[model samples]
Target: MRRPLIGIALVAVMGIVVWQWPGSDAVASAGAPRAAIASQPVANHGNWLATPTADGKLTMVAGGQLVIDAELRRLFDFLLTDSAEKPIRQIKDNARKVLAERLAPGAANVAYTLFERYIAYRDALGNVKPAADATPARLADVVGRRNALRRQFFSEEEANGLFGEEERYDRFTLDRMAIEADVSKSAADKRAALEALENALPPALRQARREPVTHLVEADKAAELRAKGASDEDLFRWRSQEFGAAAASRLGELDREQAAWEARLDRFAAERNRIQADASLSAERKQQAILALQNSQFTTQEQLRLDAALALRARQ
Candidate 1:
């Protein structure tokens, strides 16, 4: 099977992105990446969660078709996933490209070049599994053609690009993470999750590198805003409206809350002054009455306060 010459991108399906408001700096930079993490299948149906509404399965049923070992399904899935992820594929690709600047230089890392070339090949042949006859000879021939048309790892630079120590570490980490995450999953689920992960990896890492820089930029902008005496109220209000709505949209939380009661209390106290200019209320006397009422905690006293407030407000 021939691999894809180009990567898969679903962005063409999503029409006209509406930008956030003009001055709302809360928006991710136009260049900022939206990343897709590996999707976990909670599906109990043999690990298939979402079947294509039309096709009725996430991938073609690999059973009785591939004529390969159980582990071969993942190899097939790696080939099947498009250049673009379900979401973060674009950014992830960019990250890969950025990393490729280092990885592609080394011809010594056959794994990196082999993996990359096979990926293109796999993408090209999509959805169609090899007819149980993809024997060693045929597979070797396909891999050879890929090697010929692809990177020969011919130079020091190409070797460097193909294998960097740091790059190797990242690849190992991702490979282990992918394996660990989907070990319990069925073939389809594992492939789907791994594909989601592989497609997202490159750009996600790039954005990770960009994060501290973006944060620094944001901090500088904030200091400038503060110097200009910009109040946090506006920024907070805008972002609170923009971002927190998702967090706030949750319902059924009322069940978790205890009932609340609002209570008011009032009492009349007599005043007697000996040799004073007039019989008047003192702060000390008021404090004593409030303490007594609070200590009593009487509902009738609360009712009395409410009634008195209503009468007083009515007179006003």
Candidate 2:
């Protein structure tokens, strides 16, 4: 199976050959030439992973310093997925070309150099084996070894920019594990310790870490309110109190979108059923009418999930 890296979804690009899951079959083609990989239209080589343009844009900081951050690593991961089957030289070449096209000449040069080190760092990670006993100390040891490898490969500035957020999260996880393992601490003490650990994180990292859990808790509250016939204003007030006005507005927009989608699905389902039940219409005619209705109602992208939506509705 093709494993998605770091929650990044792989979109199937038209005209590019879909990646075959690496297995015993891939070994048979291990010695295949670089040209064997499908050529993309823009990059001209490798399966190009799409990056979210806002966050993943590559640019330099003021004073000509390279902006060595997680986004750069994201870009590297984007290209590296394409390089999964290619030789090192070809992989570097493809990545270099894409970087040159995306970034300024000077930034591209710096990025290519970092890309080389990143590849080496990833190759080195294959040597990091998990310990037999899954203890907090053992996990911390593994993390330390990885950090050491990163420091060896990258400058302090580069390491900080590239892995700072991740390192902070790791420390938080390890400390939490240690607290959980401490038998002397009462439940309240452990909770206080974990709260302190979260509080110690950088503001942005703390919010990023906490938002999903907060969202789930708020979602349950919102559902309860809606069950009691709460108005949009009421929901917005609650959301604003929980996540601020801007987030509340976005959440309201999302709620409207979901409502609109459910309404459309209902319309489509009713029309489809009517067509199916028409005694005068043949099965072929019913299918054609349903297809036309679908085309008229939903965009190409929305149509992709129509079956699943209908199936889910059926279950509900």
Candidate 3:
């Protein structure tokens, strides 16, 4: 043990000394090929287990010096890097393996289902062919444009069409440079808009403009609902899809229904209020008759969601 410790100390000292030398990078490169790994992390060698399974798969945003822009990566360089045949092959093979795994232990029915769908899609395409485009790229050999290339290999597009689409490559080619150009234009526009908005804000509301308004909007709505005698529980119920959701989701149908209801309610309430104010319907009579029937119990959250949806629809 003492000898081993002494040897380790000597090795560490030598390693530091050599690493500090002028030609160390070249030496490290030369040695990289010769080094033997004593162990491998789960992420090594393109293993399926290496990739993490996120709770809900989403297109996550990545940026900075480390991240290459997706539009450029996918639509430009990656599309033309000696063709995508290898990665395509990888996707095909891996997809088949994934299907087999999913259908393991007599899961023939599911496997058949996936395969049938895949084949049917291919059949519908008629004359297109498959390429081995699914294989992942190897980077360490490449030079300065490496990171840009690296970004392409692990791009959103590749991830999107991960499962084998046998006929995809035969029909379409990715135009990465054009895509990158668009991305650059979009980013520039966004930055310009933000800057313009900030300049217009007279230095007072700049911070407020940049911050999230979802919760603030929610609070304002709840307060309004409270003013209308709506209990918190009523709001919660409406938010939890306890109201108006069971109706059909066809926007035209919903619009017509909502319009009719709103028009009827507005006219009815206005007439009722006018009658009540005329001293014809006493407060006691109004309470016992019309007012008692029109109790609107709803959550502020629900109202906020509706307002937001309506705003979006109007914008559209």
- Whole-model lDDT, model 2: 0.66
Cα RMSD for candidate 3? 25.7
lDDT of 2 by residue, 1-316 (tens): 1121112222221111112221101112222221111111111111111112322446677765568776677677767775668888998998899888877788889999999998888877667654334466766776677778889999888988776666666666668778888999999999999888878866655544443246567778999999999999999999889777876887888789999999999999999999999999998999999999999999999999999999999998
Q: What does candidate 3's lDDT look like per residue over 1-316, in tens digits?
A: 0011001111111011111111011112311212110111111112111222211111223321111122211212222233335664554455456434433433433333333343333333322222112111111112112223323433444323331121121111112212233545687775665455446533322322222232345447656866899764555554345223321122224346766656755555565567577677677886665544343422455444544544555586
Give the least accurate 10-residue stretch of model 1, judged by summed lDDT.
12-21
* Top candidate, metric TM-score: 2
Number of colliding residue pairs in model 2? 0
Summing lDDT over every window of 10 consecutive residues in candidate 3, give the lowest-scoring window: 1-10
- Candidate 3 matches the true fold with a TM-score of 0.19
Q: Model 1 compared with the native: what TM-score?
A: 0.18
Which parts of model 2 are misplaced by more than 4 Å?
A: 1-62, 79-81, 84-108, 130-134, 279-289
Better of 1 and 2 by lDDT: 2
User: Considering every candidate listed, which one attains the maximal lDDT?
Assistant: 2
lDDT of each: 0.33, 0.66, 0.32
